[model samples]
Target: MKKTMKDQKMVLIILLSNIFIAFLGIGLVIPVMPSFMNLMHLTGQTMGYLVAVFAMAQLIMSPFTGRWVDRYGRKKMIIIGLFLFAVSELIFGLGTNVSVLYIARVLGGISAAFIMPGVTAYIADVTSDEERPQAMGYMSAAISTGFIIGPGIGGFLAEYGIRMPFLFAAAIAFVACVSSIFVLKEPLTKTQLAEIAANAKQANFISDFKRSLQPLYFIAFIIVFVLAFGLSAYETVFSLFSDHKFGFTPKDIAVIITISSIFGVIVQIFLFGKMVDRLGEKKLIQICLIAGAILAAVSTMISGFWTVLTVTCFIFLAFDLLRPALTTFLSRAAGIEQGFVAGMNSTYTSLGNIVGPALGGILFDVNINFPYLFSAVIIVIGLGITIFWKEKQLG
Candidate 1:
């Protein structure tokens, strides 16, 4: 029994590491995005579309990706996903043109679509219902920790060359992929796959677009879309906004994001599961939305380094907490359909992501602060939607 438990813990570690690498890859490019733009002489609008393109690919591929995981097996999809991640990063690092960059982002998105659901479903298969939330918290912590480290490293690496960070990300991801091939084992048995296959015919992501909606999930999915939209709007152009507005260098941008994310990482590591147990997902979601909206507005008004850092810290805290809260709520309501819910979450998030960057990019071109202001408005609207939502409906 003890040996079994030890092995399970190791497997969880391996799975969570994939999330860390993916987010780290994401954070790696953020600080250098402005430099990349300048190198290509790309406008804010073009850059926004650049960011949006990733989501567009993810959105397009996500519905099918989920099915592929269930059909092909989690470990198989994860291996493929990681390899794709490595390819995307390397391509982005080597590319000299905008079209090439778009191709890289598309591959990155598809990798994300594969890895997230694949790893998540793999974990769900191995863990009990009671152990699932804590495991999920660990997953979120991995992402937060990535945010803490990736930008800081990427910023300093920019000193060497703007493309250096992408190359570094690619190298590490390839290593992880090769390691996973040898170290990871498929956890699902024949019976488990058969059980999941039984529910495989439920409404997929794209099917919902034409239908009215499932009232049980309608409000929750709406909030998901708004949350992703609002976050992506400001986030897509954050580096450029900083560069143009305050003349902050890549290192300065990295310092701020890294520092701001540190506190959130700590909270996720220690307090996240308990906070969810105490506050319930609905209340926590509401709190985060309001706090985030206020912080988004405040971030734009602040000029000093310390003040901006402080506001940004709170902003990251709200987002870090909000994501898990929403995800936990969805998972709880999902019952045996964890993979399906995870896929839906990715789909709605992609929808928000697709729209947010495009609009935010245009707005940023007009005024650097417009993206944040626009995000605040969107978040406030999300809060309003949640006001009437009762927690019991999740059942």
Candidate 2:
């Protein structure tokens, strides 16, 4: 029994490590995006397209990836996803043309489609219903840690060359892929696999997704979408906005993001699970939405570096808290259809990712503050939807 427990702990560590590396790869290039735009002589609109294209690919692939996770098993999908991430990063690092950058984004999106659902399903397979929230909190902390560390490293490395961070990210992802191949184990039993197969035969991806759209589930999906959209609007234009407003460089932008992400990591690690248990998902979501909307709006008005940092820290804290809460709600509501629901979650998030950057880019060209203002409005609308929603309608 002790040996079994020890093995499970090791497996959990491996899963967390893989997730951390995947997210790190995503965050590592963020500080250098504006430099890429300058090198390509791209406009804000083109930059938006660059950001949105990745999410668009994820949006198209997530449903299929979710189904594949159940059919093929999580371990295989995870390894493949990490391998793709490495290849995509390497391509991005080496490429000079904008077309090649597009190809890299598409590959990265596809890799995310596979990895996100696979990781979520694997966690569900290993954890009991009651323990799932805490597990998810840990997962969120891993992602937060990656975001916290990646930007600092990327910014520092960019001194060597803008491409250096991309290469570093590729190396890290390759290491993760190799580790997953040797260390990761499938959590699903034969019985679970047989049941999953039977269910898969009866329902296609579209059908499974449609069936999961209960009112509570729909609300959960909407929350995920709004959160992603609001955050992405800020993220997609943040460096550019900072540069225009304060003449901040890549290193300055990296420091701001890293500091905000540090607060996010702390919230996810030390407070998220406890808050969810005490407040419940519904109440927590409402509180976060309101707080996030206010902070996001206020963030646009800040003038100094310290002021911006303080506001963004609160904004990130609220966002980080909302993520685990909403995910926990959806996971509890999903029951046995873990992979399908998780895929749908990614799909909605990808849709938001697509729209947010596109709109933000256009608004940024209009005025630097427009994106944040728009995000605040959108978040307020999301809050209103949650307020009117009835819990009993889920049944």
lDDT of 2 by residue, 261-353 (tens): 887887787877788778877888899999999988887777888888888888888888888887887777776667777888999899888
Estimate every model's Cα lDDT from 0 to 1: 0.80, 0.83
Native-vs-model 1 lDDT? 0.80
In model 1, residue pairs whose N, Cα or C atoms come closer than 3 Å (at least 3 residues apart or on different chains), thus clashing, are none
Cα lDDT tens digits, model 1, 120-218, are 777766766555556677887898888678877898889999999999999989998988888888776667667877757644655734321465566
Instruction: Quote each prediction's TM-score.
Output: 0.86, 0.89
Candidate 1: where are CA atoms >4 Å away? 1-7, 31-48, 96-99, 155-163, 202-205, 208-212, 237-252, 300-303, 364-370, 393-395
Model 1 scores worst on lDDT over the 10 consecutive residues at 203-212
Q: TM-score of predicted model 2?
A: 0.89
